[model samples]
Target: MWGDRGRGGYVVHPYRGYGSRREAFLMGRVFRQTALSDRIPRYGVLRDLADVLRRIIRWGLPEVSVEVSLGENVTTVTTDHDGYFDVHLLLEHPLPDDTSWHHAELHVVMPQAEPVHSFAEIYIPPPSADLLVISDIDDTVMYTGVANKLRMLHRLFVKQAHQRMAFPGVAALYQALHAGPSGNAKRPILYVSRGPWSIYEMLEEFFQLNRIPVGPILFLREWGISWRKPWPRRAEDHKYDVILHMLSMRDDLPCVLIGDSGQHDPEVYARIVHEFPERVRAVYIRRIERKPDRERAIDRLRDEIRHTGCDLMLAEDSLAMAEHAFEQRLISERGLEKVRRESSR
Candidate 1:
């Protein structure tokens, strides 16, 4: 989010959250914005670069008191050194099951400034959910060349949401997975990325522009930008942690993991399957890096994981992944047709 600017010169940023019937979570950063630069000017490449710089130029309001309320329950929490506030609330009553999303309000309490109020959207997956879909963003869904750091950084900062490209059939495939076999299953899709939290709004807009189903939670990394890691973050460990937390929270739900072989996705996913063999049904790794050795390694890893009761597919396109998902009963025939149509275009 660009954040809601208050007269007190402080901004309240509320992120999308997810929870179960027992507990709910919401996290955001409280920061100071000098001027009202919320809306980016639509121009050429230079204008998009300015927008990217604006997000990076942030001053966090540290140790600020933030109040979070879920239904009738309310709690107060303080921001961390980085101005990031993570609030966890225990619910006495279960949220409504008919709907997948619940609303929470966050109010910034400060003596020096006017009270700032922001709202966060929290999602509680229905008990009838068929599966959980977790996917990576970098090269799996978007066309960010992870191997080419210079080009990746250029596209990341110099391009706007409409200018960026989503992989062919990715939007259709993800929508089908979200709808599930009955077409209303509302399976929760959690996105994990190696990018920083600053780029959240851009990514959200990208999904909207591309018509991809937006998930409730997007797990982003905190690693600073560098040549080795452009939209840098901790290594594969960040993704592993996010996936582990999701699977642990939903013991009854089986998940399908999607990533690309451009980096260490195959290795991290293999490790997850070993740990939560029963909770993960399928792992789909896209062929981003077209090297004989890497492809062979993924193939070997796939064969090794077969006995763990989870199937790993190394596919070249989203359609191939959908076909395998259809065969596994993870997606419907109609969904496969949609993907087929999307891929052909």
Candidate 2:
């Protein structure tokens, strides 16, 4: 099923990988573009509406073969029904130790058609790094009322990236975490969101505009809206699966998870702490909701995780989180001061 313009193409989404001298697991999606106008910027209300309609109408090519190459190693895999591919390869030689991201190439081959080539990048944190950061984008960093559907739609569709407002002091806090304790370690920062793949570019632009540290954006799934299914589907298991995959990637590095109390972060994070008792250094849940019941629930969860040696901070704001991070030795004194200065402004 080709698109409006009778043109068919493929897109290899940005992804992340973790490995050393032996093997690496690389995963990403190859979208079958029915329309070639996916890159057009949508500014006005009509344009944004058109963009959403176009994305909803687009289709994914299934059972297509794809080749991935990095350094001297190459592997072939077929796209699943949803056009997603995960390739695991044994490296001929270990990736360079000096950099965090390594360059790779992807080629999507179709029968009786020319192959499409795209550039891809994979991140590998340096060995000297002290900690890893897993963050949630929606209410945690950006000012999206995720708990309210109508308000979230207004903020997402009406406001452009530059016009969107980030929570105060969040960028500074994230920069501090990216620098680690010594202020030089380039720690990996992975962002996970329940948003669909259609808004991936918009979120990327949002991060760039807000100066938040960028990493692999692991979105849950694409919003598959059809006449047979009008309402968008939610994957409740997405966060647990993604976080577990990231933790398994690097067992040596303890991590700090940051999310907001507006959703299921506290419950999901509590489970992670219980399962990986030794691998979690801290979990920061920003207090976005003021409900007393939410506070009581989180307090009980804190008590449950107290014996695991994982510090759970239900912070009222970014400053509180930064202060606790400094006290726990997760971030440096200078980083804490930066957060304070930024929050004051």
Candidate 3:
């Protein structure tokens, strides 16, 4: 029988005799648990590896899902294992006909978990015809737990949790970059991040919160136990591979490179400049530390960069870097103006 409980709570005890109260209670508990599992944390571990494996093979592992709805039509795509997804939106009525402001939504769903929807506004404008910005995200956009030596060692060796900090003004800068002129929209922004591959959600959340431009993403895979090799080129090689691939994808337009001085950005960017000196218009290196050794290294890198023939801007902040990018003609003048205004506010 249905029963009333205190404080507006209701208890269901159906009079049907197909099942005993104990069985009903057990079933209720199971149902509640299933619902609860959806709210699990991003870092939450599953109890059954078999279930996770099955879900991955069947429904496909949930990476990031971006859905764009324009009136009757909708487009949806989930990122791959590398946390990169490609979406090609086809319109029955091309741009002008379907010119109503479109709504873009992104949701990242973990297996048996609640979908984390973007907290920020997602807007999709007509394709291209605007300045393009390709940025690196790890230490460039978000703090990848690398600044702290102890934490870095722990994440790299012991328990891996690379999704720790958020870089200041990263989201603001991206929002500005994504924005276009009063009538036109910004070209697609490509995000390339390094390693671990597990922080896809964290990175996505940062983007959503900041309302960063969403387009193609490239993530390098973790080397696992093989990270101990003395070769510093291991990580840089993956990024270089990405750079080369991107160069091939785009015909001749120069890209804006945003990276940090923490790792091998100087080395990699220097190499890119040497190979395609004209294709890489400007490099923005985030200067986090100012130790004497780092200063010397930066000086050495500056000398090396001078040889490559690409302009370099070493800024302690993303806004500064964005400004430098705009001033150097790496991005549109409006892009830099918008970022500066937002950062000042």
Q: Pairs clashing in candidate 3?
A: 1-13
Better of 1 and 3 by TM-score: 1
By TM-score, is 2 or 3 better?
2
- Per-residue lDDT over 178-253 for candidate 1, one digit per residue giving the tens place of the 0 to 100 score: 9998998899999988777888888888988988888877888555554565545447589888888888888888
Rate residue 295 of model 1 by lDDT: 89
List, residue by residue over 2-79, the lDDT tens digit for candidate 2.
112324465566455555446766766766565535565545666566655655565666788889888888989988
The weakest ten consecutive residues by lDDT in model 3 span 24-33
* Winner on lDDT (2 vs 3): 2
For all candidates, the clash counts are: 0, 0, 1
Estimate every model's Cα lDDT from 0 to 1. 0.84, 0.79, 0.51
- Most TM-score-accurate candidate: 1
Candidate 2 Cα misplacement greater than 4 A, ranges:
1-10, 16-21, 34-43, 154-159
TM-score order of candidates, top first:
1, 2, 3
The superposed Cα distance between candidate 1 and the true structure at residue 289, in angstroms, equals 2.6
Which tens-of-lDDT digit does each residue in 223-309 have in candidate 3?
332236532334657778867765664544556677888887877877888788767767778887777887677667667767666
